[model samples]
Every structure is written in structure tokens, then in C-alpha cells.
Target: MAGLISKVFKAKWLLLGIALVLLLVWILRPFLDVFVYGIFVYYITRPIKQWLSRYIKNEGILVSVSLLMLALPLIILIAYTLLVGMSQLMAVVNSYGLTAALPSGPLTNMTTSFSQLHSNLTSGNFTLESVTDITRQDWYKTISGYSGNLPLLQAIAFSTGSTIVDIAFKLFIIFLVGFYMLKEDAHMQRWFAGTFPKLMDEHNRLLPRYASAVDADLQKLFFGNLLSIVFFAIIAAVVFEGLSIFAPVPSLQIPSPILLGILCGVSALIPIVGMWLVAGPLFLYLLISSLIAGTLFTHFGYFLFMVLAIFVFVLTIPSFVIQPFMARGQVHSGLLMFAYVLGPLVFGISGLFLGAIVLVLVTHYFGIVVPEMAAEGQESHDFDL
Candidate 1:
């Protein structure tokens, strides 16, 4: 009776534990993005934090300097660079006189509507009422203008917690998660290893090897991203410097090519940034200038630049080729590129990092664990033979 009761009690507790985990998951479903990003931040900064421990005496100061002091400025610089690059692209398009050449059609109406909205936003006279009123009018005009085209516009989708306060709160949570993770990095590692002691037993040591392999690959994946950015910076410098040699005008010659190259390379890693950046904007301006001066065909530089820019940025070498090369083949370049590309398409923005993560674990298992297991099997077979 006693043994039966013990078994029943154990089963009851197991069910209760499962229930609690489900409850927690439901509660955290909405804020999953915050936790995911926080974890990503922790992993990316882990190596630098470890390196800083030799010099910094205090844990608090080390974490702050590594994250807030250093990473913050880099983030801001990337953001600023992306904005500047976009503005230059817009300038190039405008210089083509596209707006002036446009007919008064649906596209023209949409452009005018957006222009008016921008003016209102920047005019400092924007109010809730004024903005809503403008939106309503513009919506009506846009709908009417496109009424004959398609009834494809059915619904507008929106996310919850889109207000400023909600955004700030989410950021705060992300920072809190990151801070604690960094502060307790050693503790977490110990906990992780201790959590599955059976797997770490002396006979096989499977868990230890698995964990070590996973950690090593993750470091390679994250640091590989950084190294790729540096590599891209070097390429950007070479390409821009070469382009400068044949430039007849200052506008065509990129100013501060080195700084701009670094910015472009870094910005490419950011999810929302589609920054061909230094090369894209420069090549655009050069093409337009060359065409306006009727030197596009005569100027060999223009043709060469077109080919170079198209080859480097448009042909998809950075994410596909350089990334895997820098990663040292722990992860395939094509697989990583697809993970970055399709993750967002299939699972939304958070999927970008999440996909890389899943790819890492899957690759580690097949690439490292399976091979090791096979090698051990071969050794045993040879010994028996």
C-alpha cells in the first residue's frame, strides 16, 4: 500500500508540474518577442563580457559598459546610417524628376496624400483631430481613386500594445532579462549542466560533448556575423576606393568611404534595414549623373561601377557567401541565408534570430554529434575486429 501510494503521489506531482508549465507559457505568449530578443542580446555580448572580466572588477560595471555604454552607441550609429542611406536613395530618385514627370493618377494621388501627411507631422500643428481628419479624407480619396482597380483591400491588421508606453515597458523587460542573464551567466551554466546529471555521467559523457559543441557553434554563428560585417567593410572600402579613381565629380566620388562602408556593413545585420547603403546610394547617384551628362556609355567607370554594384549587392554575395565563409563551415552559407530570409517570411520578425537558433541546434546534432557517434562506433568495430 505504501509503495502504491508513493507512485500515485509522484504521478500527481508530475501532472501538476506540467500544468504549471503550460500556465506559464500561456502567460508569456504575448511577450515572447521581448524574451527572445533579450536572450539574443545576452548571447551576443557573452564573449565580450567574458573578456572584460579580466580588466573589470565589478560585475555591475562590466555589464553596463559592455551593453549600455558600448553596444548602445553602435546601435544608434547603425540606425543613423540606415536613415541617411535611405534619404540619399530618395534624393537620387527625386533628382530623376520622377515626381514632375508623373501623371495625375492614382499613384500621384497617393504620393500627394503622403506628402501632405508628412507636412502635417513636421509642421508642429499636428493634433489627434487634425491627423484623423486628414487620414479620413485621404482614405476616402485613395479608395475612390482605386475603386475600379481591385476590391483586394478588405481589412487592416494591427498588433496589440502598439502605444508608446507599451513599447517602453517591453524594452524595460528586455533589459531586465538581459541584465540578470549577464549577471548570473556562470550560475546559469552550472544550473544547465547540473539539470541533466545523468546525461553527463562518466560512462558516455554525451551531454557534456553535446553542450560543448552547441556552445562552440553558437559562438561561431554570432561572432561570424560580426566578422562578416568587418569583411564587408573591407570590401566596401576597396570597391569605393576603386570607383573614386575614375570619378569626374565629387558627388560621384563617395565622401568618407571607410566610415560609410562600416556603417553599411553593420546596418545589413539589422532586421528592418535593407541597406545596400554606401554602394547603393553612390552607384545610384553616379548612374543618374552619368546619364544627365550623357557620359553613361562613354564613361567606362559608370559601366564598371554598374557591374560591380550589381555583382556585390544585387547578386546576393554578402548574406549567402561571406557569412558562411566567416562562420568556418559550422553552418552552411546557403542554409544560414535561407534561415535569415525565410524565417521572417514564415514566422514573422522574431523568426529571424529564432531560425538561426534552430538551425544551429539542428546542424550541431547532425554535423558534430552524429559524426562523433559514428566515429566512436567505428573505433569499437575496429577493436572487436
Candidate 2:
């Protein structure tokens, strides 16, 4: 009885110590994220660091050179893409006369048909003048609502600034971690191997295999996705220009090649619907413009179908076909369906990385524990019999 009591008291103290440590970690969680994100960045750039190190024969010089080399290309590409998108947006706004309330040009064709159909059915005159008044009133209301959101806009700006600072700090941490990880790569491996006395040989043997698996899977998913986005953007641009569907719509005057390409590329990351995310507002623009021209009733149905089809193809196809295959291939930690779903829910956007690590550790721990439990249960049953 005394021995059992002593063991229980020891366990209680151990649990208390662990709880204190966890509490400290939780409090420091936000700062830790900056370090954690840096680790992921290190993982992504490790190969480049190695290759550069070989050429320079100095780890420090190699890391510095590789970072500069990577940064220049990334900055140039992002700047060019953003400039192209913004210039196209400004051109579209300018071409529409900025504040002109009436729908004009090829867009007038749909309005003309709608007025005739409405007059035929209602036995009342449906004039373009009345339609125009209603539309201008609605636009005024929308503008007023946006004007009321000035305070919200300021809050958003402040939040954005803080977020940028956090990201910058994290990126710096990532570079530091990457440099040291590259410099002392052998020391890290040796430390890991020496820590596990019982399974030192097996653990050392499998460490490289595990690391390689993670590296291969993550690189394939990330790089393949980057390529896919660029490809899809180019395709969207070509399709928009060739179709000229937006040519008739005043809401979209941007050169179809540049504007549509960028929208398709960036929005493609949104889980379910990619380019279709923008299609709804665009369709509404056409609808409102036609209404003001007194011809919305006639060609509305046809216009609706065309917009729907474009959105469905742009948004749905990639998500259903591409995403699942990549996810299954990369996340091979034998996580069950529940963990797979809930992992992201608990982890935020960073959940994909953290969740995979947690899942792998949990699985390994259980793999050891469950068999021992089973074996003990069987032995007890035999003794009882």
C-alpha cells in the first residue's frame, strides 16, 4: 500500500510539471509561430542551399548567395504580375467614363430587346428613361453604403500593416534557421541519433528515409501547384480574349488577356471555386446595365446560362480533379478521415504542416502502445483462466 501511494504521488508531480511547461508554451504561442514558419521556409529552400554551398565552398556565402538569387526572381515576377493586373484594371475603369450611369455600346443590344418584350406583356409603356432613373438611384445607394464604411476601412488598414510586420519577422527567422540548419546539418543528425538509446541503430537508419519522404511530398505539391496556377492563368486569358464575351459588357473593359488571366490565377487558390468567384459580380453588372437600357427581359435567360457555364468550368474542374490527388499523395501519415478533416479546422492555414507532424507522431505513439496493451490483456486473461 505504501509503495503504491508513493508511485501515485510521483506521477502527480510529473503531471503537474508537464502542465506548467505546456501553460508556458501556450502563452508564448504567437512568438513561436514566427520561429515555426521559419522552419517551413528552411525546409522549402534546403535543396537550393545545398546546391549553392557546393559551388561556393563556404556555407555562409552559399546561403547568402542563394537567398539573393531566389529573392530577385521572386520580386521581379511578383512586381510584373501586379503591375500588369493593376494597369488593366485602371484602363477598364477609365474606358467606362468612370461615373457614367448608363450602359452603352454593344451592351445596348440586350437592353433594346428587353424593353420591347416588357411592353408587349404588360400593356404599359416601359421606357428606357424610367429604367435609367432606377439604376442611378441604386448605384447612389451602394456608393453611400461604401462611404459609411470609412471607419471599417481604417481598421482593415491597421490590421493589414500588423500582419505584414509579422510576416516579415517570420521570414527573417526562417532565413536564420535555414542558414544554421545548412551549416550544422551533420550535428543535428548526430544529436537525433544519440538521443534514442534503445532504438538508436534503427532510428538513425530510418531518419533519412523519413526526412526524404517529407521533402519529396512537400516539394512536389508546392512546386506543382505553382506551375498549375501559371498554366491555368494563361489558359483563362486566352479563353476570355477568344470568346469576347466580356467585350460587350461595360463592367469589364480591361484587356481580357491580362485581367482575366490574373483573376483566374490568384483566385484559383480558393478551395472550391476559383475564377467563378469573380463571375457573379460580373453577371450582376450585365444584368443591371441591361435593366437600365429597358431590354433586360429578352436576353436575360441566354446571358444567365453563358455566365453559369463559364463559372462552373473555371472553378469546379480543378478542385474536383487536381486537389484530392495531391493531398492524398503528400499527406501519407495514415491519418483517418476524421483527423484529416479536423486537422485543418484546429490548425488554421498552417494546419496542413503542423497537423501532418502531429498525426505522424500520434500514429507512431499508438503503434507502440496498442500492441503492449493487447499483449497485457491477453496474458491477464490466460492467468485468470
Candidate 3:
């Protein structure tokens, strides 16, 4: 009877503890992005902290220098890139007269083209070959006169301003939270480990190990991503600049090579889409412009094709070669791909990190921890019997 009462009391306390944890998670839900960003900053700068610790020995000073060396430069670079890219984008819009290109002009041209085709068909002069030729010529003519409307430009400008403000705020929060996390990393770890019930020896041992595994995975994901971004950015800039300088015609040039290159690097983070998000629009523009200007089949067209081929190759290498090599024994490529793609869909931008954390925890528990716990449980059960 006494044993039963004791068991009931313990179960009630366990339930209460779980409730408290759930409550804490609820409270922290809104700031999940901040914490996730902080963790990323923590892992990325951890090596620097350790290296500097050898000489400095003061944790605060070590963390401060590491943050300044890594985080500050990174933040500044990102800000500068964003500002330059926006200016470049606006320039491209103005140069292409995108702000003046209305659907009405294109639609009217398309309607005229179709009317002519219909007249030819009804006049008993239509053949498949003629129809195709006429259609192609009409499209070229229509695209040549393209100019974006004012309303669209106004919308784009408004959205761009709002997006810039939002990104700036988020970045500020990320850096602010990250600074403290880097400084008190040791204390944070101790606090986390100490959160579990002291009586549960298994949990106390397993929790830290699990955390270490997660940390290692986060390091691979973030550092690999950063390296890929830098590599792709450099490659893209060189390729675009080379084409711009040597292309046979000025019409074949890529507008704002730096902006396009940075966008290409940013696109590397998205799984299957990759750099095509930047390359696709650029290629389409070049193709249309070349066709309209009767530059197709010329040296300019050849150079444009070369640019496309090179960009495709660059995009392919990361997915097929670099990523596989980087993730070789750490995490499965398929799982990482899923996390990269689905994370943003489910958890917004921060999902990339959050999804990875969940993946690591789930995989660790099922692949390693669960089995060990089960084996121990079986042994204990046999001993009791």
C-alpha cells in the first residue's frame, strides 16, 4: 500500500514537470527564431572562441573578439550586398524600361499578330510552317516593344522598402540574441543539462550527448552552406563579368553582375530550385532581347548559350559533388534535402535551422539512444524476473 502511494506521488510530480516544460515551450515559441539564430551564431563562431581561448583565457573577451571578427563582418557584408543589389535591381528595371512596360502594349501587339494569322489562315494561304514562322516573328516583335507599367513599379518599390525594413529588424534581433548566447554558452549548456531530474541518471548522461550530436550537425549544415555561398558567388561574378566584357554585342550583357551573383549565391540555400531562380530570368531576358534584336545565331547568341551552360554546370556541381562530399558521413543527403526544402514552408525562414534541429534529435533518439535504452530496459526486466 505504501509503495503504491509513493508511485502515485512520483507520477503526479512527473506529470507536473512535463506540464511546466510544455508551458515553457509555449512561452518561448515566439522567440524561437531568435534562439535558433543565436545557436547558429554560437556554433559558427565556437571554433574561433576555442582558438582564442588558448591565449586569452577570459571567456568574455574571447567571445567579444570572436563575435566582432566573424559576426560583425558577416552582418556588414550582408547589409552592403543588400543595398547594392537593390540599387542594381532598380537600375535594371529602369534600363529595361520595365517600369513602363504595360501588359496593354504587349496584349495589343499579340492581338494584332493573332488577327493577321487568322486572316492568312482564312485566306487559304495557311500552312503549319507558315503559321510557326509567323507566330515566332510576332512574338519577337511584341517582346521588342516591352515596357513595364507605372503601377507595377510603384508596387515593387513599396514591397522592396517593406522587405528591407523587416530583414533589418530580424537581423538586429539575431545579432543581439546571438551575442549573449556566445558569451554565456558554457552557462547555457550547464543550465540545460541541469534541467532534467537528477534522479534520472540515464537522462543526465544522454541529454548532453544528444546536444553534442545536434551541435555537430548544425556546424556542418551552417559552415557547409556558408562555404557554398562564397564559392558560388565568386564563380558567378567571374563568369558574368567575363561575358559582359567579351560578349560580341552590348545587348547580350547581363545587367548588374554583382547583384545577380549575390542572388545566385542566396539561391544555393534552397534545395532543388538552386541558382535557377536567378539564372532563369536572366537567360529568358537575354533570349528575348537577342531574338528581338535579330542577334540570334550570331556571336552574341553563342556567348549567351555559353553563359547558360556554365551557370547550369555551377549549379549542378554543388548538388551532385560538393554537398554529397560535405555530408558524406554526417547526415543523409535525402534527409538534408527535405529539411532544406520543407523547413521554410513549415516554419518560415528560420525553419531551415529549426527543421535541422528536429531532424537531428529524432534521428539521434531513434538510431542510437532508443536502442541503448531498450537494451538496458530488457536487462533490468530480466534481472527483476
Candidate 4:
């Protein structure tokens, strides 16, 4: 009777423990991407951190420096993309003679009003009357009707601000997670091994060995990806520059084709959609520029040919031919491609990470671990895998 009561108590606690774990999982489901990305960031920076540890004594400072270095390229990419993108788009529009869309007379008049208003404000003549006078101008009235969607614009701004905040929060979480992992990963690994000793045995070796192998391959895969990106960017830049020689109009040629090429390479991180993010906008810019300039009839053939060359030489050929060789020894080209392709098709965005992970684990286990285990594998830190 006493033993039965003890068993009942243990069962109840175990059930409660499971319930709490499930609750925790449910709470964290929304942040799965942030956590996965954090893990990715951790691995990518781990080597650098290890190297830095030789000189940097403080854990916090080391992690910060590593992350900053990693972020430098991203920050530069975004800032340059925005600054140049705006100028390029506007240049195209101006070059194309979009005068039919907005008359030059009204714009010149509007600019004069703005200049006068600025001068009045600076000279301390700022008042409702002055503002009203500027708004009352004929040119201002020409656009006032189009600007009637003030409430809608306000809502959009609010939504955009909220999204930025959410994204900022997620990035903080990702870095925080990475920081802690860098600081305490060794401790955590030791604790994990001690907490589950029997897991060292053959039946349990299945998971750890498989995981270790996958981890190694993933590291190699990422390194290979870096190399691929570099090569792709170089190749893309050259191709785009070469194609520019055929442009009938300057606007039809890519502005800073090298930067666009680098961005195309970086866009691979976006997965599934990939280079389209860079190339799509570019194609659209060209099409709109030619259309508005009334050069479409004469130049449409060039536009079509340019896009085809980009897709064939810069995109399609690289994926199947170049990248496979880049990742040759690390991952099977066919398998890697399939993972990248079918992953999104099968499971949506998360599938991008998931598919690669699953591929590594399965390939490593069946190909290596299973064979060794079946032959009675020896124990080592290698076995600790």
C-alpha cells in the first residue's frame, strides 16, 4: 500500500512536469525563428570567439565585438542599398520623361512654395497664416486632393513603427541568446552529458553521434555557402557589367552593378525567393524606365534579352553548376539543392532551415553512425558524438 502511494505521487509529478514543458513550448512557438537564427549566429561566430578568447578576457566584450563585425557588412549593405536605390529609381523616372504623370510646372511651383515657407520659418515668421498661405497655393492644391488619405497614411506609419519595434525586439533576443551560449556553452554541454549518462550507450548514441555529425557538416555547409556567395557575387558583377555594353539608354544599365551583384549573393539567405528579391526590382526598374520614356517599342527586345541573360548565366547556371562544386565535399550537391528547393515547397519558410538540418542528420546517421554501431563501435569523445 505504501509503495502504491509512492508510485502514484511520482506519476502525478511526472504528469505535471510534462504539462509545464508543453506550456513553455506553446509560449515559445511564436519565437521559433528568432531562436533558430540565434543558434545559427552562435555557430557562425563561435570560431571567431574562440580565436578572440586568446586576447580578450571579458566574455561580454568578445561576443559584442564578434557580433559587431558580423553586423558591419549587413549594416553597410542596407544603408548603401537604401541610399543608392532611391537615387537610382528617381534618376530612372526623371530620365524616362514621366512628365505626363506629374507636370513640371506644378512641381517647380511647389518647390518654390516650400523654399519660401522654409525661409519664412527660419526668419521667425512662422505662423498659421504663413502656413495657410503656402498650402493655399495653386500648386499645393493640385496635390492636396491626392494627399487626402492622411488618416490612411497615419495608420500605415503606425503599423510600420510597430513592426520595426517587433523586429528590434527579436534581434535583441537573438543576440542575447547567442551571447549566453558563447559564455556558457561548454558548461551547458558538460551538464547535459552528466544529466544523461546512459545516453552514451549504443541505443542512445544514435542521437548524440548523429547530432555531432550533423553539426560538423552544417559548419562545413555554412563555410561553403560563404565561398559560394563570394564567387556568385563576382560572377554576377562581371555578367551584369558585360551586359551593360548593350544598353541603348544609360538608365537601362544597372547602376553600381557590383553592389547589386553582392546584394544578389546576400539574398540567398532569403531562401526560395532568393535572387528574385534583387533581380525583380531591377527588371521592373528597367521595364518602367523604357515604358515611360516611350522607348519600349525600340528597346523592349534589349530588355528581354538582358533579363534572359541574367537568369540563365547569373542565376540558373550558378545554382546547378557553380554552387555544387563549391559545396562538393561538404554536402551532396543534389541533396543540398533538393533540400533548399523542396523544403520551402513542402513546409514554407521555416523549411529553409529545417530541410537542411534534417538532411544532415539523416545522411550522417544512416551513412556513418549506423554502419559503425552495427559493427560495435568503440567509445571515445568521438563516440561522445
Candidate 5:
């Protein structure tokens, strides 16, 4: 009877623990959204905080100033870069006699290529005459359709307003979370450790070790790789802009150096030839624009640029692949699985950074908590030795 009662009591506690976890998840769902975004901002800004703490004579003042200096430029640059891209797109559209000329540039060029492939698959091959006829028909239909839907201006206004509101809310949450995370990061780590001391055994210590390894991996991967990418992107954009100015192609659209720089920089964060993801579209844009302008024969400069782009990509192959893996190896002994998680299911681009951190924390806790718990139960038997 005593043994039977103990088994029943253990089962009850197990069920109760599960129930409490479910309840907590339910309660925290709303706040978790904000916290998730907060975590991204925190990770990105953590290095800045560290730099301030290390170099600046005044810690608090330096952190405050660093944040202001960091934030102001980021906000302005993102806004201005996006604005220029939009402006260029709109100008390209307007330049074509089509009233709303569909802008096809380095970015949209990829979409156009995919669409053309889709058309080829669906619509079959066409002779030159048929192609010309189809193009004319499509152009006519597009213009007429757009004219008929001119009242979409109101819809555009509504959509723009909603987008602005949403962006404002997201930015507000990010900064709010970032500030607190930076301010109380040390306290938070302490809090994380303190809650489980009684529950921890030898095995439980493994959890903290694993978590620390994961955190260290992420800090190096996200920050170091990000800086490297940004530096390379600036170099690429300067090279591309210079190429375009002198390239023999009658290129009407010059890629904004800053915009391309930022785009390439961001793309560099993604693993394995992501810079090519940016470059491929850029080259396609040049190709299409060259075709439309009827200067394909004279565009020797673009050929040279195309060659240069390929060379740069080849040169950076080591940096993009081998370097990050080497960096990761130093921090995480078993993180190959963690690196693969980002490419498939990005919550957003930031998911790469956030997902790695969460996985680390979970594994850390499991490794530490489980081993410690097992060791506790083993103590009686082992003590007999």
C-alpha cells in the first residue's frame, strides 16, 4: 500500500507540472510576441553595450550616448535607403512611355525572370512575331486595366497608413525591450541561474554549460559575420557604381550605391552564397535593361563588370562559408544542426539570430537539469561505493 501510494503521488505531481507549464504558456502568449522582438534588439545591441563598457571612461553616460548615436543613424539610414529605392522604382516606371512603366531593376529583375520561366512552362515557346504580338497585347491590357482601377489610390492610401502604424508599433516595442534588456542583462542572467539551484545536480550543470556555449556561438556568428558582410557590401556597391558610370551600356537606371550596399550587407547574413542572391538579380536587371535599350552589342563594360562580380564572389567564398563555420566551431562544439535551422523557417530575417539563442537556452537547461536530477537520484547508490 505504501509503494502504490508513492507511485500515484509521483504521477500526480508529473501531471500537475505539465498543467502548470501549459497554463503559463497560455498566460505569456501575448507578452511573448513583444519579448521575442525584444530579444532580437537585445542581441544586436549587446555588442555595442560591451564596447561602451570596455572603452568608455563613463559607463552609464557612454551607454546612453552610444545607444543614441547608434539608433539615430540606423533609423535615418533605413528610412532614407527605402525611400530612395522606392523613388527609383517609381521614376523607372514613369520614364517608360507606358504612363506607369513597370519598373524592372536589379531587385524586380529576378521576379521578372521567374515570371518569364513560369510563362515558358505554361504558355509554350513563341516565334519572334508571336512574342512581339504577345508583348503588345499584354502592354495594352496592362494600361487599360490600370486606367480602369485608378480609384485604387484610396486603397493604396489605406494600406500605406496601416503599414506605417504597424512599423511604428514594432519599432516602439523593439526599443522598449532593447533598453530593458541592455540595462538588466546581468541581473537577468543571475535570475536565470538562481531559480534552479535547488533543482540542479551534476547533470544540471551541463545545461548551463551548453547554454553558455550556444550564447557564445550566437554572439560571434551574428555580430562578427554581420560586420564582415557590411564591410564587403560597401566595397561591392562602390565597385558596382563605378562600373555603371563607365559601362558602355545605355543604362538609364544607376543602382543607388547606398541602397545596394545595405541590401548586399543584409543578404550577407544568410549562409552560403547569399551575396550571390543579391548579385544575380543585379546582373539580370542589367541584362533586361540592356535588351530594352537595344544596346546589348555595345555593352562590353557590363561584360567586364559581370566578370568582376564573379571574381569577387569567388574570392569571398572562403569568408562566406569556411570562415563562419570555423568561427562557430570555436564557440559551439555541436552546432551544425543549429546553423541549418535558419534557412527553412525564418520568423523573419532576425529569426536566424533568435532561433539559435533559444535552441541554446533550451539545450542548456536540459543538459544541466537532467544530469543533475539523475545524479541526485544516483547519490544513494553511488555513496555506497
Candidate 6:
């Protein structure tokens, strides 16, 4: 009768816990992005928080100093770099007369010109050289003329303003939540441990060990990935800059070396495909340009060769050589790769971290927690016998 009553009491608490969890999830659904980002920020700044804690006893002061000294500056630097890279990329697009082709006026004119060119080609009267000349003169002029319109500028300004506001609001919420989380990290952990039922004594005892394993894996994944990004970005920029300076064909130079490098770095974060995201588009652009101009086939060939070389040296080599060393046995390479790839697809950008966390927790429960519980049960059975 006592055992039956205890089981019933536990069931009642379990149902209450489930209901509370559902309520909390519903309430937090709107701010999920902010909370997810806050967790990421907390993980990234955890080491700083620990280090600062040694010198400062007050958690509030330590978190504030860490945020100001580390997080704020990092955010500002990233924002500045992005703005500069975008400006440089826009300048390159403008220089190439690409943006001019985007407006309706220029697109309509290009369509008319293309129809005439197609008709001439079908008649066999227009040679490739004549077609090239027409493209150089008519296409260039039409694209260049479209750039002076006022509506395009106004549209761009409005879009930029709205994007900035959205980004700022998100950042504010992330930092706010992250600051509090960091300040109360220990208390949160204690509360979480206490929430588990007494029936889960073994699990409660093993919780710290499980948490430590998760933290180690997360640290390795985050820091190793960060290093990989920086390494690829710098290598890509240097390789492209070298090609611009030394390549035999000046016309085949990478248009925006810095911007391309930044993009390559961002692409490097994507698992499996990696830097190919940037290199593939560049290859296509050069191929099309060479075919259209007809005179730069050799230049395009050399440019393509250089791009492949950069991919091999900067991207492929490091994935094998540097990443293993950085990972330090904290997490399986295949699993981390899967988490990086599938996380964003399922959960948006925050999925990257969340997926890894879920994987780690599941692995820990099965590998450590379950086995330990079974061994304890066996011991208890032996003692009863």
C-alpha cells in the first residue's frame, strides 16, 4: 500500500511538471531567438566569466566587465568589418555595371537589345566579334545610365534602415538575457539539479559529470570552429591578393578580394561544402566572362586554377590537418559536422548550438548515465541475494 501511494504521488508530480514545462514553452515561443542567442553568448563568454570570477567576487560586476571588455568590442568589430566589406562589394558591383542591370529600365533595354542580337545571330550575318562589340557598347551604356535614378537610392536607404533597426533590437534582447544568465549560472545549475525527483538519485549524482562533458564538447566545437573561420579567411584573402598582384591577366583579378575572403570565411562554417560556396560562384563568373569576351580564355583558365589551389590549400588541407588538433578529443568529428550542417536547417542559426547540445546530452545519458544506473541496480540485486 505504501509503495502504491508513493508511485501515485510521483505520477502526480510528473504530470504537474509536464504542464509547467508546456506553459513555459508557450510563453517563451516568441522570444525563442533571443533566448537561443543568449545561450550561445553565455557559452562563448563562459571562460571569461570564470577567469573574471577569480579576481572579482560579485557575479554582476564580473559579467558586466566581461560583456563590456569582451562581448561589446567583439560585436562592434564584427559589425564594422561587415559594413566595410559590404561597401567594398557594392563598389565592385557598381564598377562592373552589374547594379545598373538590376533596375527595370536597364533590364527592359537589355531585353530589346538581346532580341536584336539573337535575330542577327540566327541570320548568320553577325560574327562573334561583332556581337562582342555590340555588347561592349550598348550593354555598358545602358547599365551605366540606369545608376543615376533616385528611386533605387531611396529604396536601398529604406531597406538598410529597417534592417539595422531589426538587428539592433535582437542584439539588445540577446545581451540582456545573456547578462542575467551569466550572473546566475551557478544558481541556475543548482535549481536544475534540485528539480529532478528523488527517484532519479543516480541521475542527480551524475548530473555534474554529464554537464562537464557537454561543456568540454561545446568549448572544443565553438573555439575550434572559430579558429577555422579566421584561418580560412586570412588565407583566402592573401591568396586572392597574391593572384591580383601576380596573375598574368589583369582583367581576371578578383574584383573584391577582402569581401570575397570574408564570404569564404562565412562559407567555411558550413559543413562538407565549406569554401566551395564562394569558389563555385567565382568559377562560374569567370567562365561566363571568358566565353562572352572570347579573348580571355587563358586568363580565365589561370584564374580557375588559382581558385582551385586556394580551395585545396586554405580549406581542404586545414579540415584534415588543423581541425583534428584543435578538437582535442572532446567531440567526434563526424557528429560535430552533422550538428553544424543539420542544426541550422532544422532550428535556424541557433540550431547549430542547440543540435550539438542535444547530441551531447543524449550521448551522455546513454553512454554514462544509463550504464551507471544499470551497474548500481546489479549491485543492489547482488546485495539482496
lDDT of 4 at 64: 89
Clashing pairs in 6: none
Q: Give candidate 6's total backbone clashes.
A: 0
Separate clash counts for every candidate: 0, 4, 6, 2, 9, 0
Deviation (Å) of 377 in candidate 3: 5.1
Instruction: Write one digit per residue (lDDT tens) for candidate 5, span 1-385.
Output: 9999989787997889899999999987745545665665565567787777777777566656656766546544533443344344344444565533453332233223333333334353334565555677776764574453334433433433334667677677767777777787789888877876753433546656666666775566555553454455556656666766666655634465545655565565556765677677777887778777887657656666565764565336535554453344243423533442332123423344455566656655565556666778799679987
Candidate 2 wrongly placed segments (more than 4 Å)? 1-24, 71-154, 157-168, 202-212, 223-385
**Model 4, 1-385: lDDT tens per residue?**
9999989787997789899999999999978766766766676677778788899999889988887776435434432333332233334455688635532331222222333333334455234655545655644664564454444444433532335578689778978887888788889878888877787654757667766777777765544564466557667777887888678887678765765776676565445687788889888988887888888778878888899999998889888865663442346655776675455334433344567777877788788777777656555545778
- Candidate 6 lDDT, 219-248, residue by residue in tens: 665555644554666677777778777767
How far off is residue 365 in model 4, in Å?
A: 4.4
Candidate 3 residue spans exceeding 4 A from truth: 1-19, 54-57, 72-173, 191-200, 226-297, 300-329, 377-385
Residues 291-367 of candidate 2 have per-residue lDDT tens digits of: 77655666566456556645655555655655443332334323423342343334433443455455544544455
Summarize candidate 3's per-residue lDDT along 103-205 as a digit string, tens digits.
2322222222333333334455334665556677776664443322333334433533334676577677777677787787778777766775563356437
lDDT of candidate 5 vs native? 0.55
Ranking by lDDT: 6, 4, 3, 1, 5, 2
Error of 3 at 326 (Å): 3.5
Better of 4 and 5 by lDDT: 4
lDDT of 1 by residue, 96-200 (tens): 776555333322233333333333344543346655467777767744655532322111011222455776787688778878888997898788778867766
Q: What's the ranking of the predictions by TM-score, best on top?
A: 1, 3, 6, 4, 5, 2
Once superposed on the true structure, which residue ranges of model 1 sit more than 4 Å away at CA? 1-8, 75-161, 230-293, 297-325, 368-385
**Residue 118 displacement in candidate 2 (angstroms):** 38
User: Ten-residue segment with the worst summed lDDT in candidate 1?
Assistant: 151-160
- TM-scores of the models, in the given order? 0.57, 0.45, 0.57, 0.54, 0.53, 0.56
